[model samples]
Target: MRVSSSIDSIYQNNVTLAQDLKSFVDTHIISNKYEKWHYISRIKSLESFALKLERGGISSSSTSLDDFFACTIVVENSTQIDKAKDLVNKFCDIKCKRPNSNNFTHKQSSSFEFDDLRLYVTIKDDVTVPNEQIKKIVFEIQIKTFLFHAWTIAVHDLTYKSDEINWGKQRVAYQIRAVLEQAECAIADILNLSKLPQLDKNNKETKALNKILNVFKNHFNKIDLPSDLVRLCSNTSLLLNQFEVKENQLDAFLKAETSAGRGTKMLGLSPYQIVLLGIFYQCEDKLLSVLMGEIKLSIKIVITRELLDFIQPDIRKFILDNSIPGIIVLA
Candidate 1:
């Protein structure tokens, strides 16, 4: 009866953790704006827990099971895996992390394990919660790419976990997995296609936009950027022929600025704003000239508003106080 009561309590705790995990994920991961992703969660059923206990080969204690509650975060591609890992690290206390074979070299064409990244974490003390349930329990977070996740959902259980596990069915499952693996490889290598250069050869604007997006992707570790903002920035960059702002240069500038004690002042700016600021610093004279002379009044106003939105509050105050001559005359 005591063991049964303990199991019941554990099940309730797992349920609470699952709920809190969703809230935590919604707060951190959902807000990041990945291109494609979804999450699924489940608390182990009471019967499953009992079966594990009766099996008696592993730790029978409920508290010892890391996967009492589990959540799977499936992303469109492997690139977002790092971003997910970063968020997990920031928000939770990682007890153990199992790195998956993302760069797997499959020697056997017929075998596929489709191992995915798994993290066992307890909620960090810094993250606020309604109850202490999260801190007490360790839960699992599995990160899987879309292709692999699809196979697992559609075919894995029917073949691998089926009551009648025939060799033929298992072989078919492996064959399907191999195909999915090839598809993932092709998707990863699509950027390196030989014809892509020829196709985009004349599209300098597209190239500029891509570069800007890449910058955002690397710095923010996000799969997608705001298209309108990116397009606007890309156009401005192309206008001045100054889209060649290297990432290292931007990083150095930010480091120097932060060191000089403007970190607090710059705290209000978003990631997009920071990138724009770096661009502004790189081509200030050209940008100022283009804004002041050539651009239309409406364009000038829009550009000015975006730049002003990006700049530090104190800098905006400075511009206001000085009247900044042509800077905000139309704005």
Candidate 2:
């Protein structure tokens, strides 16, 4: 049950390296606004490390424990999985491992297929660990979409670590997994369809929208908004384009409101709520009503004030013109 002292020593020595790698990964993820669901952890406890070594069939004396350190990045959809992989490749040396094949069928193992999206990264050079025996370190970065992560967790709990794995239960688990896989694909397709068309960077409307987005990003301290809220904002850009709200106009409005003590105080709002307010400010009456219906009365009042403060008379008239009776209240 006990791990060798050498293994424990390697683990203890490389803990700092693991933490540093986690921070590095976190920075990249946040800076790129890649995905909101993610976390980093070191391989803790001797039993887990020993189990990993046994699973990989590696000797305690020869192999270092660095590879056990890992971070999981959960993206919104399957498309972002590839994007996450590319992002990780930019900063670290990726170690490619060949798929382990099943001896009976001579096909790649199901376990390998399950983890095909994970990338192994390593610090190529030896890191100096003070008062420790470890010299080099390696870490894992796994990219998974939300549904895929759910499926994996379900499978792990039901099959891999279960006390008794019955054939009937295994069959049922696989069936559930298949349904989840299909659902994942459907969600990815929907996400792709909902995405905004790539606007030309040089276009005036594109530039204006970019500037507004930058302001919101800065205002939120560059926090990654939830994917659903981000998509909502993207959809709202169409209304911004229709209204021809220029960047300078938005900037002046925000400044004037803030200076006049009319801007919504953000202290009480979550980051998503703040982003939602920014998006709702640009929405037409119909779309605005849809968003308004989802929020609480307090949030609705705050958003209404922000909208009234920032929307110009002409833009307000445009929204009024497009308003549907009983659905939108302009007051």
Top-lDDT structure, candidate number:
1
Model 1, residue 326: distance off in Å is: 47
Model 2 — which ten-residue stretch has the worst lDDT? 294-303
| TM-score: model 1 vs. ground truth | 0.52
Clashes (backbone N, CA, C under 3 Å), per candidate, total: 0, 0
- Model 1 alpha-carbon drift over 4 Å, by segment: 1-28, 31-35, 56-62, 100-110, 195-331
- Give lDDT tens digits, candidate 2, residues 79-133: 6766776776665667653233222433343422264355666543433333232
> How well does candidate 2 score on lDDT at residue 46?
61
lDDT of 1 by residue, 83-126 (tens): 87887787788888775344555445545765678888887888
lDDT (Cα) of model 2:
0.54
Clashing pairs in 2: none
Query: Which segments of model 2 are wrong by more than 4 Å?
Result: 1-10, 27-37, 59-66, 97-113, 124-135, 190-331
Q: Find the 10 residues in a row with the least total lDDT in model 1.
A: 295-304
Instruction: Return the clash pairs for model 1, or none.
Output: none
